[model samples]
Target chain A: MTVTLAIDCMGGDHGPSVTIPAALHFLRADRKARIILVGRTEAIEPHLGTALAEFGERLRVHRASEVVGMDEPPAQAMRSKKDSSMRVAVDLVKSGDAQAAVSAGNTGALMAISRFVLKTLPGIDRPAICSTLPTLRGQTHVLDLGANVDCSPEHLLQFAIMGAMLVAAVEHNERPSVGLLNIGEEEIKGNETVKQAGELLRKSGLNFYGNVEGNDIYKGTVDVVVCDGFVGNVALKTSEGLAQMLATFLREQFSRNWMTKLAAIFAMSALKGFKHKVDSRRYNGASLLGLRGVVVKSHGSADAFAFEQAIWRAAEAARNRLIERITERMERERSAA
Target chain B: MTVTLAIDCMGGDHGPSVTIPAALHFLRADRKARIILVGRTEAIEPHLGTALAEFGERLRVHRASEVVGMDEPPAQAMRSKKDSSMRVAVDLVKSGDAQAAVSAGNTGALMAISRFVLKTLPGIDRPAICSTLPTLRGQTHVLDLGANVDCSPEHLLQFAIMGAMLVAAVEHNERPSVGLLNIGEEEIKGNETVKQAGELLRKSGLNFYGNVEGNDIYKGTVDVVVCDGFVGNVALKTSEGLAQMLATFLREQFSRNWMTKLAAIFAMSALKGFKHKVDSRRYNGASLLGLRGVVVKSHGSADAFAFEQAIWRAAEAARNRLIERITERMERERSAA
Candidate 1:
């Protein structure tokens, strides 16, 4: 089936400078894919001028009146910026025009607007944010990144099923293993909620590994890690902070003295390879799972390549029928129960 | 006043192999400090043989009948291993024979036994696990690191108060700044508990910085970050995992080829310095704050140097009268309210 993506081009730190270039790059890469760039007409026109001339009908713009500020709260923005670029992008997905939507706007606003418009899939109580990051082995997906702060044990189990279904559909894994993030690995270890979730997961149809800790996320012991939004958000942000610190140290070390500077020059290629492996930009998209339509969030400060990666993620998820697969899994689990 | 520390010599992965040497190193470093090494006499004797001859009465052993297994649950271990090394070390603190207690045993058991015996200080409901971590600016103390999973706004405020007091006492800061760890930096962001905690912190007498994300931990934007134990634990562990991953990648890169190896040799000293800066062992101790007596939790797999750091932390807290300072602050806040 032909695929289409709606882009909230007026979102993120750089706005049109980043999103328009990213859209052009994605269009160049995927022949069958088309994108509806949603933003103010004046802002979109300048960035997409020559590219739009070349791509013709394949790249088009859907004008929206307002833009959601990065700092605005979700509920207020929802009431005021009803015709915002982020809202229009989600609306395209809600209608039959686009298969998936991509945004680099305010995360809370995006989640709220998407949930309001697209709505949660059948048998799912809430839409969770799932993101994939690089691991030593390959890549691992962690979910409920910041969507639902106070998740019940049942919510965690549902996150597992949804995460597994997404991985199974997107990566073609038959049964992706899911790990319940907790303080300790034993059956009786974590707090009451985690312990109860473990019991529910053991009986769930998905491949459920026992309890995992913060360290296990990077260890790549499982394909998916399930946790409440609060823990997942902290873990994700902490990793981001540590990675930034290490990178800063590396840069400082290389510039310390002439001897180290000279050594850094010689070791440039090796360091380059290592940097590529751990680069956060390489894995930029965070899927808003459990939504009826495919939606991927690009980091607010992501560069062109990173934003393009978000587009690719959204396109792939749509092509693989991720929503249908998740729906089927939910229905199967419910019927069995 | 001289400070004395009680050590659970039979705890940790290596038992006396780690604890006995740590105690000896600590004794050698601080002449005014003394240790009560509690464990099986046989297990303690072999490691302390020649050191006792040189150090004489400075180092002494307090024998215990049983040992707590690393895998044993806290409640089970508490009932069965009443005379265990960990319990007796805490008992030394309770009996006023030692100013503080240090352990590398099962964290849950140590916390349970400490709470049951030493008890919480006045105006504090629960003990929070607080620790100093190396940051880009310097070191920051983060609290409630896996101690209380379901923290209310009131609990977070208490943690903020306890963390501020500890930092003020040990670091001698007049009014140390505290941050409420949140998913976002905005006032309106975060879940209900965090939002409520923010409001409380704003009104509280402490130096309250608004909200900070995970990266702020390493960025050292504030002296202390207050989060629930669940989020704090995940953030701590996730950082550990990422640090491990980065180190592994660096090693792999440096060994890739002879040219890279040659470059690594030249940059060895710079790399070593960087390693020393981010070294987890240097920041090994986690203070169980809000307790009537000082308790420091060392990493389970810590070596002598790491364990010694834990002892140093405990001694410093004891000397500074952390508990008394916390009590005074609590009393002040309560009276004002």
Candidate 2:
């Protein structure tokens, strides 16, 4: 069975410069994998040729006439650019032409288009963007990285269920421990939404790990960390920013004097490996879980390496039957209730 | 004139084990600075022997019979533990026995006790905790870190004003720019609280830089980042955890093999300096601004080094007359309005 991935070729900061080569690389690496390049013909055709010779029949292109601007509002952009590469990519998944859809466009736009085109899974109130972040112990999954900002307790509870399901699907865990992101570890520490969410989660009988603090996220204390989009987004971005800052600061420190500069030479390998561990590219794609169809959003600044990772992530999600597993779990819970 | 800092001997994770020695160190460093240790006589006397002898007349212990527990609620703790060390510390600041008060006790207890004992500055709705963190560019102040979680628009505006004032006071910037933290940079991107706060911030002027994203916090794009306690605490702890995780990962990578171990030895200085730059202990103390008196909270896990830094921070806040400056600024804004 060949895995098909629909790529929104006109997305991301570098656009075709990165995405085009990335798609070609993915097709070249996996002989059983096929890609439908969704973008303007003129831009993607040239880049696809040299790389497509090896996988001649496997690679195909579906020209998307309109491109969504990164600056446009997700709702407005979805309405205006109905035939955008992102929308078309999602549509392919909706139509069952592709196993999964991948886009590196405006996050809001991708979420909006994915939800509109693919629709939500039954028993799912809101779709959440779940991303895996590298942690000290290994990797931890954080949900609602930025799907719904002002989420209610019910929405958060739903996100928790979907997040746990997604993590279990990908990590192959029997039952992943879920944690609610809060200011403190105490049961009564967060805001009203979080407090209510905690109550619902406790009652939900999921493998809930009670409340976990922001510091606990990277400590690998829980398999799944759940929160409303606003706090989760802030935490994700803050982590990214801090990692970048630390890397930059280390470089500047090493470059200060000749002694430190020499140290930098010897430490280059370790530094590079450290960079790889924290690099956003290593975990670039976020799955929009709780949707009927699989839709992954690659980081906006994704390069070839990141895009390839996105393809691998998409393939993994599809192979794991993530949507089906979530549906089944929800159905079992509903029936039991 | 000599600076006097009231040390809460009963505060923090280890209490006097860290605080007493730290105060002695500060007293030794600054001969003109006086220290008043506030706690039970037996609790503090054991920690201060040779150190107090060296300081001679510079150090004095103010006996406070009661102590607030770590798990106690702030309001209940404040109401019950009237003679608590935290309360005594605030009393020192209120009665002008100490120029500033430093504590690492229960944060809520500290805030509540400070507000009750020292009172709020004129025209201030609530007190805010402002702490500095090392950023990519330099360092920036994040205010209301864990003080006012569910803040009103007016409270947020006050936090912004107080944050800017605190930054300007300590950083010595002529006019510090304040950024209202939101989900997006656009004026209309955040929830209702942010929208209303943005309008109030713009109208109030005072060098308001529009809404800033989480990524921008570490970029040091603005002097002061203002948000409600919940969001600010999340961002703060997330950044701290990320830095710690990265540092740990780098250490683990360096210790992986003989070659990496040699590189680690060579890179020790640069790595140490980088760690120092991002160390929470170096900037652990957060000034409780908007209160009539100056109060700083050291980290619960603060060591002697962290406690000393807290003392320094308190001294700086006192020297800058932060409360006076904030009051004057608020008065000026009110008069203009």
Candidate 3:
């Protein structure tokens, strides 16, 4: 079976300078995968070179006359940049031409375009951005990374259900424990929204694990951690900032003195392996759950290696039939209700 | 002009095992500083051996009959355990017997006890907790770390002002630019609360630097970064978790093989220095801002070294007249309005 991935070729900062090379790398690496590069032909052609000829019929281009700027407002971009690369890529997934769509563009624009073009699954109220974090125990999925910042209790309940479904389908957890991120672990400890959400989650009967504090994210106490976009975004970004800071600090420390330099040489292999394990780019892409079709958003600053990882991730999502599982779970939920 | 700090002798996990020894260390280190140990007399006397004779007059004790358990709710603890060490420490600050107070007890209980005793500073709606983070550039102050979880735009503006005052007084930033923590750097980005806060901050005539993203926290883009307690707490904890994870990953990598262990020896000095710089315990104390008196909350898990750092932080805050500066700033704002 040929798995076609629709690429938003003109997304991100460096555009085709990064995306074109990344697409070619994916195509060369995976024989079972086909690439549908969606963007302006002129912009993508120069970067394609002779590598584009090697793929032959497996590779194709869909010209998108318009491109959305990273700084453009989401609503304005959606209205004005109707034929933008992001829209074209999402449309391909919508029209069944591609099994999945990938973009490293303005996250808001990608989400908006995906939502408008692909539509939400039957019972999913809002589409959530779910990403896996390497924790002390293993890995945990955190949802609504920045989909809906001002989420209500109902929205949170929906996020919890969707996040659990995704974790169950992709992570193969039989009954994934869901935790609501709160200031304190106790039921009585959060703001009004959390209080209401806690009640709703309890009633939802979705393997609710009660409230988890900020520190619990690394502990991996639960399979799914649910929160509004505002809190989730802050948590995600803070983790990213701290990781970057630590890596930079280590580099500086290793170069500070002769002893440290010697230590660095002795620990070079270990350090490299450690860096490889924790590299954000290695896990650069996140699945946009609740969409009718499989859609993944690669990190904005993803390099070719990171982009390649994203391709693998997209393949995994497709192979797992994540959307089908979610639909089935929603249908079951409806019937149970 | 003897500066006295009321130490909560019966607080923290180890209680007097850590606090008494720490107080003795502080007393021996600084002759000009007076230490007022507030707790049960029987509990503190055993920890002070020879040091008691050397500073008999300088080291005083205030008898507090009750103890607040770490598990008790904040309100319940404050109401029922009026004579708790935390409350007694705050009472000393309020009564003018001490220049400041320090505690490692329940954070919520301390906040409530301090507010109940010292009262909020004029024109301040609520108190905020500000802590210093060691960044590459220097230390940065993040306000409302866990004070008010759900804050309004006006409350955030007040937090920004208080944070700026703190940076100026404590960090010595002459005109520290304050940044509103948001999902993106764009002024138009973030949720409704951030949007409203941005508008108010721009017109408040403060040295506002506009919206700052999560990645910019450690980059030292602004001297003071202000946000609601929920976001701030998540950011603080997430940064901590990431730092710990990175440290763990590095340790595991360095010890995995013999070659790496040899390299680790060479990198020991630089790595130790880096650890020293980023260690939270080295900067463990948090100031309870917007209160009429200075109160620094140390981490409950602090050791002797961390406690010493907290003592130094308290003395520095006292010497800098942080409370006085905040009071003056608030008065100026009122008069200007």
What's the lDDT for candidate 1? Answer: 0.91
Candidate No. with top DockQ:
1
TM-score of 3: 0.95
Sort order, DockQ high to low: 1, 2, 3
lDDT of 2 by residue, B251-332 (tens): 8889989999999999999988987777777777988999988899998889999989989989987888788889888988
Worst 10 residues of 3 chain A by lDDT: A328-337
Q: Give candidate 1 regions above 4 Å deviation.
A: none
User: What are the per-residue Cα lDDT tens digits for candidate 1 across A1-337?
Assistant: 5699999999999999999999999899898999999999999998876887888878889999999999888998788888999999999999979999999999999999999999999989999999997777889999989999888898998899889988987899979999999987778767888999998899888888889999999889899999999789889988888888888888888889898898788888778988998988989999999999999999999999999999999999999989999999889888877
Each prediction's whole-model lDDT (CA): 0.91, 0.87, 0.85
Q: What DockQ does candidate 1 score?
A: 0.74
Which candidate should be chosen as best, given lDDT against the real structure?
Answer: 1
Alpha carbon deviation, residue B264, candidate 3 (Å): 1.8
Q: What's model 2's TM-score? A: 0.95
Of candidate 2 chain B, the 10-residue stretch with the lowest lDDT total is: B48-57
Candidate 2, A1-337: lDDT as tens digits:
4889999999988888888788887777777889888999998877866665667777888989999888778989889888899999999998999999998899889988888888899988889989998888898999887777789988888888888888777789869999999888888787898999998889885899999888888888999999888888888888777777776888889998999999999998998888777777888889898899888888888889998898888987887888898898788767766
Deviation (Å) of A112 in candidate 3: 1.7
- Clash statistics: count for each candidate: 0, 1, 8
The residue pairs found clashing in candidate 1 are: none
